[model samples]
Target: MPEEFRTTRRAFVGALAATTALVSSPFVRTAAANETFKIGILTDLTGSFSDLGGPGTGVAAEIAMQEIGGQVLGRKVELLIADHQHKANVGLALAREWIERRDLKAFVDVMNSGIAIGVNKLVGDYKRLAFYSAAATDKISEDACNEYGIHWNTDTYAQTNAVAASMIGQGLDSWFFIVADYEFGHAMQASMDQAVKKAGGKVVGAVRHPLQTLDFSSYVLQAQASGAKVIAIASGGNDTVNTIKQAQEFGVTRRGQKVVALLPYLSDIHAVGLKTMQGLRFIDAWYWGMDDKSKEFADRFYARFKKRPTAVQASVYSSTLQYLKAVEKLGTDDPGKIRQYFLNTTLNDAFLRNGRLLPNGRMTHDVYLVEVKTPEESKGEWDYEKVIATVPADKAFRPLSESACKLRA
Candidate 1:
């Protein structure tokens, strides 16, 4: 070989060898592993829960990213979001792929209780962290509780006690229950029944319809025939919206019966519109324009999405921010230490106030009982709920003594 050519070839070979070694080196592998702190948001995007928990939850997480300055523990943050579609198999499949393939360290905003429980199981199995940001089934914090999962938003217990108590106190005593025939709906109906009986009211009758009943005429007629002074719809999201709208069509509302949403989200009221949902009472975990901090966040959120956020979106923002805070303090994503920090700390934020993450995975916080505003009473669009009452944190959930969490046992 010519002398100059030999020298050039040697330099090229050395560079190529260095690159090859770098690719196979353990140090490089570890660096790649620690390059990103990823969080997955598994939620309903195109299903019954979508109206209340669609892309809005993802937007909430992004705002948390902005608020946290876009980094945690010196690692770049990445958000992985997917539509669970309110299906168990779909949610579990997406969760498994994210956890195993993408190293998704945490998950948020699973809307359906069935899907939330499935994702919780995955988080438990992988010893990862997750927050049930939108699901309301209390069973996850009780019979199905796990160490790595925190059930953050409002649940059946908090919602029922506050809204039901207010309605009962208002002398809306006798009730007819129209419930969705699913895990979440059943749990809510049971809670509503307990509240009514405890408060000296009677559940005159009850009926269960399929998950996405296109028409609630028969159910509304049944409720009207029950002759109960109040009709309680033990459901959420689209189910609640459809029931209320159909009740009006069937003359159920034309009569004197009061319609109540047992687990209402701001989005549900928005979808059903103030004209239809007005006078209906419900409880929520957070209201966007409730206070100074809430309004501040809501204004930013509105600036981005051009629509007001729901309690479910607020749940996603708060839970994800709190988890990131733990990761920063510990300087690593140690699930055990993060879980301990969550269990021990009292969190106060735009979405929650003096909230405690219970040992059984229930994030306990005060919730509000709000009545939907009438069309004429509203100042502008997105002004839906008017706060009627507040239920404190300690009183908002199932007590540790009454819980079935193995942690309690």
Candidate 2:
């Protein structure tokens, strides 16, 4: 074995042993030979999305395990994680190995949209459960719905539709866009266009940046010349942060125009900081400061990690907890049984409550509109998003009837 793989295996085994020891004690339940529940966390641990998807998700799963007393029913849950490297092929390969060889009960948290879509198909073919919390493409649940997968959190359609419709109605009618070049980027752009048109706005022009383009000056320059009242960016995680910061530096906002990031979160805001991230608006699924439920969750997360949980982290925790719950209830690790249980049941977890699992594999949860707070007005670190609107679960996502899902049909 390669050195890194060997090290990763050793660490994974170590973690497994530690957790098992705790769970097998008097406080928690022990795993039955017939009921060892395994879950795989595939994420960009060393790539673009890692800033939001890395330590946060790993720790979040641990938090869920601890809260559940490290057990469920009469079984123990074991988590296995792999680094997807932001590559679709790598994600698919790892997913296949985990399902076929490692006996993973489910695959969760494939972060990049392209990778998420790729793994979604594999999950369907193998009849293994895939719970997606990080990928944002609506097509994962819409066009590509599967009996074995559930989209657990926000999608491109929800994020763009909510922000674009509101901004257009607010007199930000003319729009210019900087989009990443991929399925996710295209879906976001398309959703934004639909929303803008619905609200009587027009897209002046748009530019597409390559997937790995770090310098966004050229893209911002094109948007600057479009003369649109609002410059919109269709990207997320690090891409979103870099583009927003570059737009500010290039004075894209000073040219009688404002910049709007379609997706903003605690991780990106922390990276960009309040000074440069202020006055920008975006859509979010969960903000730690929003409500009593959210506050309680955030407090516990910070107590353990010394950092507030990002929406992605919270999504990981909820999805992990929900899957484990399903595994216990079904009394089997058969993928189809676990999947059916997940869809037919209501999920009331830490990050989401009364959230429904739609037939198209979409998990309908509350989404919010938020603006970044200015540095001087900020109270502390992670005080990034101030909720502007609360979109109810039903209104927050695309309807199932509109989804061209083969499974639903």
State every prediction's TM-score relative to the real structure: 0.89, 0.89
lDDT of each candidate versus the true structure:
0.78, 0.76
lDDT of 1 at 194: 91
lDDT of 2 by residue, 136-254 (tens): 88888887777877898898889988787777778889999898888788888988888888878999998888775789988988888888999988877788889988988988767
Best by TM-score: 2
Q: lDDT per residue, candidate 1, 2-67, as tens digits?
A: 011111211322332343222211110012334777787766555677667766776788788778
Model 2 scores a C-alpha lDDT of 0.76
Off by over 4 Å in 2: 1-36
**Which candidate number would show the highest lDDT if scored against the true structure?**
1
RMSD of 2: 5.3
